[model samples]
Target: MSDAPGPDQAGPQTQLPDPPRPPLPPTAPERGGPRARLLGIAGLVLTVLFLPAGLVLSIAALVTGVRSRKRARRVLAPAPGAVAGIVLAVISLVLALSQITLYAIAWDDLNGYVTCRESALTIDDKKTCQDEYLPRIEHRFHLPKGSLRQDPSWP
Candidate 1:
């Protein structure tokens, strides 16, 4: 006589209750403690500094902040300052490498000039060899091979 089906025919109510709510999202950093804020700030700054030492410090600060925030049940956010520090460090390294590359290019040119002169001298073109090569090598390196037979001086 009941309109609803009995348990055997109901098929477990067809609709489930809402799943238990997920843990609430953390509130923003303003809700965190002073120490957490400081760690975040420090991490951001060190990352910007870009130096090897700065990078190390920045990483430490970031780790500290993350740990502290987790313990405090606060929201954690990446600091812009730390990101800048990391960028700076990378740029500095790149610049150093570029400078080295330029110096290597110049050095190679100088070596080529010296080698050409040595070849000329081997063919008894002493005047051409000395005029084109010797002074430059002596001025730059402060020494030149005295005898080709004994010193190849490729390096």
Candidate 2:
């Protein structure tokens, strides 16, 4: 028989399989749940309104957001709300820290001013101390002159 098959002699042709498809890219985590979203909103609002409360709320939100993100990541879903909450929490934390630092500096300056006045050797020296430090403290804190006061009750 001839090597080449005629129409009648030809058997059913075997089809080649298609090439394998590439794997899909990883998807973002799922959106955070209701509690997480609420916490994010609350945290952001408190951060703007009351710094101390905001700091606390921000910490709570960060914790909640991180947990929500972890849960979503396990399921391979998007967690946009959780991510936003985390970001807002970080900003709130930074603002709270800055305020705390400023307060500490102002307190230290006031204390130093009191010490300077008490340690002055004469009326002139006391006047010089006030003249030198009062302006600096006022300028730094944007306070009116002579706003700093020393109370005997305070240690």
Candidate 3:
């Protein structure tokens, strides 16, 4: 006496149309245009890992990051790695510049210190080397007297 359809009995089925999907945004930054993630990562690695090439690579990273940001803005898309890349590049640039300055300004002094330390045969000899190095270096920087003390582990 059941009115419902039974097994093997076909019932009337009406399919509803799929819900309308909102169209994608105007443009996707992550989609098709030149991806800057590789550059960003390369710049970051160069800055942190290889300082010899960091001076050049840092500048490259900075330029690429800035360009990426500009391009993203021009296209009105969100930038993913631009800001991070720029920040890291700036830090690396500073470190690279400082390294260059130290080498350029105190090359002879540093060379002398290394040679003296290498030839030192005893703790007293090393201490003497430290004494000579500290004064010269302090004078170069115009540091106040007693500003820098010799390391106890000069050996």
Winner by TM-score: 3
Q: Give the per-residue lDDT of model 1 (tens digit) for 8-59.
A: 7854457778999998754443233344344445544544454444445445
Q: By TM-score, highest first, what's the ranking?
A: 3, 2, 1
How far off is residue 137 in model 1, in Å?
13
TM-score of each: 0.25, 0.50, 0.63
Displacement of the residue 89 alpha carbon in candidate 2, Å: 0.7
lDDT of 2 at 135: 76
What TM-score does model 1 achieve against the real structure?
Answer: 0.25
Q: What number of clashing residue pairs does each candidate have, in the order they appear? A: 8, 6, 0
Q: lDDT per model, in order?
A: 0.49, 0.74, 0.70
Model 3 lDDT tens row, 4-100: 8999898988999999999986344433223344554565577567766766766776777777677788878877766776777777788777777
Q: TM-score of the candidate numbered 2?
A: 0.50
Task: Sort the candidates on lDDT, descending order.
Answer: 2, 3, 1
